[model samples]
Target: MLLPSRPAPVLALALLLPPLAAAAQTPMTATEFEAYATGKTLTYAQGGTIFGTEQYLPNRRVRWAFTAQECQEGHWYEADSQICFVYESESDPQCWAFWQEGGRLKARFAGDPDGTELTEVEQSKTPLACAGPDVGV
Candidate 1:
């Protein structure tokens, strides 16, 4: 008696899917992002070097500071499936696509997957430290 053979094409397709699925990361929706980031401070790195840190506050407000720099106040909103931020220092909106991977947030500028990518290095519940205006006066 001859045994039935498995579908070769189906098997091949299944084998090819795992890597593709893993590579295709889905961007988080606005609700998911807010729930994950609110009341948290996240530090991001680019090219394995520290880039900046952001503290997420209620009502979509945020505070961002570069390494050892003064903080800037901003607010974020969802636009065209991307998170767009407007800072008090700059009126132009800076947009990014955010996703969760490895239990941390990953962001790409302008939703460009091949462009600059920032990886979250640390997360905390502590608020960001912002020095008062005119320090060392």
Candidate 2:
């Protein structure tokens, strides 16, 4: 007798992936990115380690909290078809290449040789718990 499987297995597969691995081939636009990120707090992980969390707010406002440090307030903007963020603590803009994968957002560090990639592990409506500075919610 052939027994049916319970939960269907999700194959880890990518079709004709580009040189920039982890990218969704087509990068997300500013409008699409804003629409997908707003009102959600997203948890990102890299190399199986919980990196940090960022809460997206209206007007492209963002509150980022590293796991080992205090939170920083930042705002993201679109430049050259890439999403870049400038935080109060840093002058250099941290840019990223974003894409949608399986209904979830994934990001790759843009214009860097580090090959640092982050996957959206979790998301919620709850805001990030920020402390230690004059950062807005």
Candidate 3:
């Protein structure tokens, strides 16, 4: 006796399953992730991963060193939290940077004038900073 064959629809779905799953697993948008990052300070957990510091100015301007790991991986607010900026680590001298404007998140690297678009990650409580001055005001 011959065994029954799989349905054509099932076979088609099996072929498309992997790509569909991958699309669903795409990384969270900058906006989505930024919500979790704002109003907080980020620093390197280890000394050598990247080294940098953030200086909080009295005028609400945060001066940062992009070369430093903390600055490169860190996120901060500008203009009294009117805008949020993030420095994502990268292999080249250029790194991923993003900011929020008009209820949207825009991203760019280095000095690129044309920026990429981003989606916001779900909001999450800011992570605690262990190395810097207490931000607990």
Candidate 4:
């Protein structure tokens, strides 16, 4: 009996793809995102580093604080299949595409195919903190 020949590189590549394929998450809508995030403080990470954290409140309200930046309060809404956020400090909206991976969520900055990506790494009862008179507000 003759055995079929297979390229070693191709076989190795095929074997390595299962985990990668499983990591791809289905994109989420605004409704789904809000339902999942409400009343929770979610910490996001990028490239194994803590990126920032956001506290989700009722009625689409959000408070976001970067690792080394001031905390900004914002609200999110759905527009054209993207979840766009507008902060009180910055009127311009920052949009993102959210994906649900198992019990966590991931996001990619909008309009940049190769830009920054974020994955949820933690959820805490304590909210984000900021300095100034508007810190806890």
Q: Count the backbone clashes (under 3 Å) in each candidate.
A: 0, 0, 6, 0
- Relative to the true structure, how large is the alpha-carbon lDDT of every model? 0.76, 0.74, 0.33, 0.71
Runs in model 1 lying further than 4 Å from the true structure: 1-23, 111-114
Candidate 2 lDDT: 0.74
For lDDT, candidate 1 versus 2, the one ahead is 1
The TM-score between candidate 2 and the true structure equals 0.79
Runs in model 2 with CA error above 4 Å?
Answer: 1-24, 133-137
- Residues 36-118, candidate 4: write the lDDT tens digits: 98989998876667777888889999998877677788888998777888888775788887888767887866654344467
Better of 3 and 4 by TM-score: 4
Ranking of all candidate structures by their TM-score, best first: 2, 1, 4, 3
Question: Candidate 2 has which clashing residue pairs, if any?
Answer: none
Rank by lDDT (best first): 1, 2, 4, 3
Clash-forming residue pairs, model 1: none
Q: Per-residue lDDT tens digits of candidate 2, residues 21-136?
A: 65436888999999999999998876556778899999999999876567788899998777899888777888887888888877766745544567788999999987775656
The TM-score of predicted model 1 comes to 0.78
